[model samples]
Target: MATTVRRTSITLPAARLGPENPLPALRTPADPHQVDERERVRFPPGMARRIGYAPLRSLLPVRRLDGYDRHRTPTDLEAIVIENDRLRATVLPGLGGRVYSLVHKSTGRELLYRNPVVQPANFGLANAWFSGGIEWNIGATGHTTLSCAPVHAARVPAPDGGEMLRLWEWERLRDLPFQVDLWLPEAAEFLLVGVRIRNPHQRAAPVYWWSGIAVPESPDTRVIAPADEAWHFGHERSLRRVPVPEWQGADRTYPLRGERAADYFYEVPDAARKWITALDGEGHGLVQTSTDLLRGRKLFLWGNGPAGQRWQRWLTEPGTDGYIEIQAGLARTQLEHIRLEATSELCWLEAYGPLAADPAAVHGTDWTAARDAVSRGLEAALPRSDVERAYQAWLGCADTEPKEILATGSGWGALEVLHGRFDLPGTPFDEATLGEEQRPWVELLHNGRLPQGPLSTPPGPTLVAPHWRDLLETAPADALAEYHLGVAQWHAGDRAQAVRSWERSLKTAESCWVMRCLAVADVESGHPKRAAERYLRAFELAAEDPGQAHAVLAGLAREAVPALLAAARAGDAGALLGALPVSVRERGRFRLMGAQVLLAQGEVREARAVFDAGFEVDDLGEGEETLSDTWFAIAERLVAGAGPVTESIRRRARAEHPLPDAYNFGL
Candidate 1:
């Protein structure tokens, strides 16, 4: 099941060559660049120059000391060495196992890599080469070069070198300032890529581009994004509904695993379609066009081999590494599409260039201006009224079903326990029906959502994920009570009773495990701030022995930081400052938050002070003050003259509505 991989070559006038036309002669491997309605590959006369546009020109291996840059080092192509200081770090996990070199340049940490283990002296499995340079190759006898570039393209070693399975190294000599170009040989091809990198900063930094090719293992690959949100996917594997930590630079792949290969794309805001999976089958494939840049249009090329070879061993690799992908959209652009909020400092074009009629150079409007237009459209669409109406509509729905009830299980117990929580008119449980040991925790469940953080020590009775507590005969029975009770109360909207029932189950015995359930309840009830405070108290209680204060505080802080920042971004004062510690008033994670508030209130000088202080520090660590802290302080300074001081009132808000469901709830 092998087909020869070939690339098309083109000729251009030397006078036309300049900063643009980085690789003028480079063309599609299939010798065609046009796709008809049916998406068959087409090789139009002007397709080569059409692919060569402004944005593509922008990506002509531009070198900049501060920003993105490419380095080409002319080395003895005969022998290649990629090594780092660490012993075990020499090899990346997935590759047939290619040893890499360690450099202290970016992350200041030593890691392994295979610079570019391509195939054929001019072609790469991971990279594609296109240029008008010297020729070279390493055949059975040894290495040889003709009119190609003076390079020794390293080839991936084959366990058994069959004529169809030869490995070649394609080298782009850095010293020569040569260019190597690679494009989808097929009119539409899926490109899957895997990149494992080490961030050099002691403080976390953003990886400007999450650019990887999406390749399809099978033919039936599809791409999808949320209809509402402006962005495609935020940080973490989950979508940002209420906002959580690391929401700023999230470009993670969704969780999807199975024997079948399905390539699917999801929007950032909607948790449903975050993944672009490829199903394991033959002759089935998909393609789509993005309104973004770099990726002219996505191509899903699959079933390249014999039928029933859809789930080939190579296609089984997890993530985009196994599936084909291209860069057209990212977190920021995806977000800007759905919401009319403040603009994010992001530019996808900077990484993959821009989309244009020409594949060889950059084209279309400049990304910054294009982003501005999108913002205008978003602003027009996302009025305050629209958001409010959506919120209202979302809140009015109360279709409690068996499946949903089960899913909202807090990862605990059975149906009977869930039913008990409902004291409906027709169906009722008598006092005698109540279990003695479970009554206490059940009562707590009736109290409402538990505080955020671990609800109890030693991890409360493992009612959820029952396998963990399978040894205890009582666990199943107790779980049944909890599950039924939860469902009943939840259906009736009697949150108090339901919360109390769940809580009482934990209090059955004085074991420390009950805290987590309580914490879950708190966050679920739209009271994370309250949960944070209660967690603090619970921590104090548990601290007498094996206090998890540090761990709990750290977790809460990590979770709260991003949410608070988002609230700040959205200008929700109460949501921002309420139930929060004064220690965090204008400090740490909330530093920028506080500054935004001040700036909004017309506190110029004071705001400047905040920014000034913030600029001084580089990193924001746990409980440590940095520039972010300074920003909050500045906001505080600006607000010093306004508003009456009020102590944070810790009032219990009734669970009238369901807590905002997580985007990727289970994940």
Candidate 2:
């Protein structure tokens, strides 16, 4: 299986930035003094001081601020290059192990945007980010905390037939390990990127991956994909029935212009291979494709305008032009959160390279014609059958089985009861065959929860409360029905009834959802002790269902904040920490809060311990807008006052351990 392997080194005269650099002097303002009035209003009291701020210095042509800069004199920077007959790839092990450059030998064109300079900007959660190349972002979000840190890299034989440049790193934010292998088969036009991500912890945690591919942007640049809808920013749903590329009043299929805005769109996949291509007028372009393993395809563009152009210049060198990013992810969309099961591993394959065809033939909104053109372009580079076979082998479809019908007693069946239709030909019972006692359950199963297609707005509890109540009365033994009744009751302003229903449901089946409902009721009823206990129980149940568990944990964390603060004020840091569920306590922010409280109480040792433990998990709290500053403040304080820590420990705690600022200011 091993193919020809060769490795070589190249030296690039890169700018070395420091106090002597031509760029404005870099400043690390004291944590307490770095505050923004706008952010002060949003963060909790004292939190503003802890999170610190990045001052906006120069702001006209290029904004100079606190973060990594690349404006110093030339220095010999070594880079590793791996290549085949058709393509060559270079990796910078020192700079986040990113693919610094990729070129198609035939055209002598860079497959990815090669930023001539290592210009770092104040756009990431960590306050520093470099543009261009393929940035493998994992853990918290944005470009990843490790985006600028060194990674473990080596050249090895690929599984098929070629050399692969392997890069890996342990993500401390979530305690997960991530790795990517870059392969270029001999005579093949495409480069294969195989990714492996694993959850090494004993419990599940939220995780995400975004592979950002930067390419040349121009007026004739167009995005081609087979999709009928796209999730705007991966949150707002946008439906386009006609051109599909048209959004609101603008056509996103063409190059962006005359706007100071940015757009994040994920195409709705319709085939096994989900893909998006950014092609120029000459038909020379970069196409990114993945199998079902990678579920999301995204297109990002910074419009052409004063502000947009300014931002573009800030992140790249003068001669290097602005570029658009074609990204792919392992989730439904960029903002759609996903959790990895305990000790589970996720693997997927993605390919990217040059594509050539007639611009006239490929430029359009018709997906069929556009796809054919792309296929033709790819075939011209390599054997179509060989490419197909390689892709299929990487996908490993032979071992997968067709999905079977769900068993009636499974937990997922409860969801089916809410949405499944019982009028199908294979139904076990008909209207006449059903007995009087089964009528209610049958009706509940057959009645759809919501109409087909996207909902304009969420349904009010009153709309479905009565139906759930009726189903609960008839199916007293069905825990799922009782749980649904509880949800309906809670939303209908019947807290007492909701608690009772949830308790009853727990007697039949112990579920995190029911526990979470009880916890919410207790919190509202001024029973923090009871609420804390319920939250703990719910955390234990999360191992069975990560999605539901994570949802419940989020709610619990928000509701428990006041109670934890109260306990801390009572001079009981242990009690406050213990009251938090395992999931909540494992997060970086919550642990930081606890440590700060202990430090204020003069429990220096306990505070240090708490701070050390916080570094173990990557906790991307509720939102970036609120927690980014808080996290930075906590890190700054830990470095300043985590008593007697070694130099190595301090460096690791500050740089490698803390969550990067990239997550806060997304790409």
Candidate 3:
């Protein structure tokens, strides 16, 4: 259905493209006859006769493609276009519902970087990521695994007085449902994007969302946002702090040729209205504003050097120029994954439009002045009240039972009222409705009284174990129940039983939490090799942001540190090497431990090499001075040997702790 209101039109049409050729499946080279039957089991019952155990593999021989391929030029494709008097926006509903293009009517300027071709790149965890357009990334890291997939889309009447284009999908990983509604009022110049995400399951899970907006990269382009500091990506999955736009005495807003890649996550100031802009020197660009619900802004760009230029060609076509991403996330930054409570819903409003302003005013540091100027200009072009009304209408159209707005009918006003009323609280388990045998265990899990780690009180676990055991016996297929049973058993000093419970839990369902528990149990049981493998598997399953992944791996590494250090001290270098988790190179503490162990064993050359593998700059935050002392000691000891301290080592040390006397210490 298509609708026209005043000078605007919303149309959904199907167009023909060409023949589809899907990418080939990725397969391991191992032969089927070489597979071990024991490894083939999803989860083995217990430790068996075989001293060595191989990991399990999927039974299916082939994998499916991410989604249907409609990018082929001659094939039939479905598209939705929303147009106003001054702006036109095109969306590819069948292609992940991506906003394919947005153009300003007056100047005929393309506000978005529209790829000349629908090219897919192997960049996401699912090995299929499409370049160009605005992609709604939800769930795990990178462009969502479903970025190349289709979504359910429809055109519906706006409650106030316009038309809305709605797209929704049930994510594959956790069955989390997400819906997005795009509205363009007849009199408004901006496009309103409303989002709703729901967790239907009864168990809590990590949820992440980022709206990725791609724009053409130019030498004079600048990313403007109201932020002072940013979390800059550093070595070893660490985050170093620097000023926004300019970091370490270098201007990063627009990179010159051969400059390093710029990936920054900024924490937006908490305000009623926050905005980020990406504009060229011509004073033509896009502005994205959101209420308090969306609080993060990010700027990512592939540098204009040969490497990045090559990557640009790889991600798209040869003639396609490099681009930058202006992203808005629901959390403080994209690196911080938000935990969505069980059976709860989250909703937010975001708006995007073409804005024309003086280049100097747009890039000014006085955010208040710049914001006031932009807001006034926007109001004059299209009244703010009309945008608010469009948002209210969108909420009514999207939700069957719309939330009542008690404040002044403005968008931000409604958000303030909703925020105060609900607080977006998590749903806790209701013990009154639980069965008798399940009540105690459910209470233990739900209530925050129980201690979770080594510092936890003893009586809590002692009191909760029997109830968890009872639930496990009655509900053998419940993965979470089995997992909690293992936790209780572990806390009660029943190590062997805990491992068995965890194995059973894995058999019920392959969860990263279960894998981590099993890994910890393996380390405690004096099986470091198995523990390392389990940790690797858990890391793979995590598929999280770099910060979260680093934190998780750091915890697991700390748990296995005792075993690793013991093996290294015993001069069992092979065991020590095997005990290190996969990607140990990406961890600062692991590198430090490896170097210290090698030094203790009198392997001066190896110690120097290990020490040369510098620690993460941001990982050693307040303890940097302490680590600097340790580094000086190590360097002094190494200098006494045949190998001399290299300039790279001194440079790295100075980069972390820039004290004047850092390298002037006597050997």
Best by TM-score: 3
State model 2's lDDT.
0.55
lDDT comparing candidate 3 with the true structure: 0.56
Compose the digit string of candidate 3's lDDT tens values, residues 1-667.
Answer: 2334221223322122121211111122121112234542432222121112221121111122322222334334456778778777887766677888888778898888877765454355343566787889886545675666666555556664666676666554444567777777665567788888877656675677889999988887877677777766522244455676666675676644225455677756675356677778776688887656777788877766544555565455557677888898876545445667887878877888888877667567665555566666555655545556656666666653212211111122122222123222211112232343333344444452222232111111122224335544454345665666676566545768878987987887775567777877776677787776676566455434333333344444444444545444335433344444466444455566566556666675676665455443212221124345555546555554555557766665456534323111111
What C-alpha lDDT, on a 0 to 100 scale, does residue 490 get in candidate 2?
Answer: 60
Candidate 3 backbone collisions, by pair: 17-73, 17-74, 17-75, 18-72, 18-73, 18-74, 18-75
Q: TM-scores of the models, in the given order?
A: 0.27, 0.51, 0.54
CA RMSD (A), model 3 = 16.8
Order of candidate numbers by TM-score, starting with the best:
3, 2, 1
Residue 390 CA displacement from its true place in model 1, Å: 46
Q: 1-667 in candidate 1: lDDT tens per residue?
A: 2212221222211111011111111111111111232211222223222222211111111111111012223322222222112111121111211222222222342211122322121112112221111112111011111112122121221111211111112111110111111111111121111111122112322221222333333232222222222212211222122221112342122112122221222323322222211112221112122223222221122222321132222112113223334323333321111111121111111111111112111111232332233333333423324333322332222111111100010111122234233221111123433443344445444443222233343322212212122222233325334433433343334557656765765555432223433443566677666555444444345444554433333234333444433333324433434334454343333455455555655665755655556421111211123333333333343345355322221111112212122100111
Could you tell me how far off, in angstroms, the CA of residue 332 lies in candidate 2 after the best superposition?
2.5
Candidate 2 lDDT over 1-667, as tens digits, reads 2233344455543443221111111122112113235644554343343233212221111112222234444555546676777778777766666788888887899878787777655444343567788888775445565655656555554656445666665554454566676677766678887777766455776677888888888888887765656644321222122335666687766657426444445555545456777888888888877656676777777776554554576566566677888888876455433668886778777777887877777776565677678766765654435545665664442122212211111122122223333221111212332343333444555552222211111111111324345554454345666665666566445768877877887888786667766876776688777776776666456534533433344444444454445434434434545555675565555565566566556566666565444352222211233334444445545666656556665565568445542323322
Model 3 off-target regions past 4 Å? 1-76, 234-236, 255-258, 363-389, 400-667
Off by over 4 Å in 1: 1-325, 328-474, 477-501, 510-513, 523-533, 547-549, 556-633, 636-667
Per-structure clash totals for the candidates: 153, 11, 7
Per-residue error at 98 for model 2, in Å?
1.1
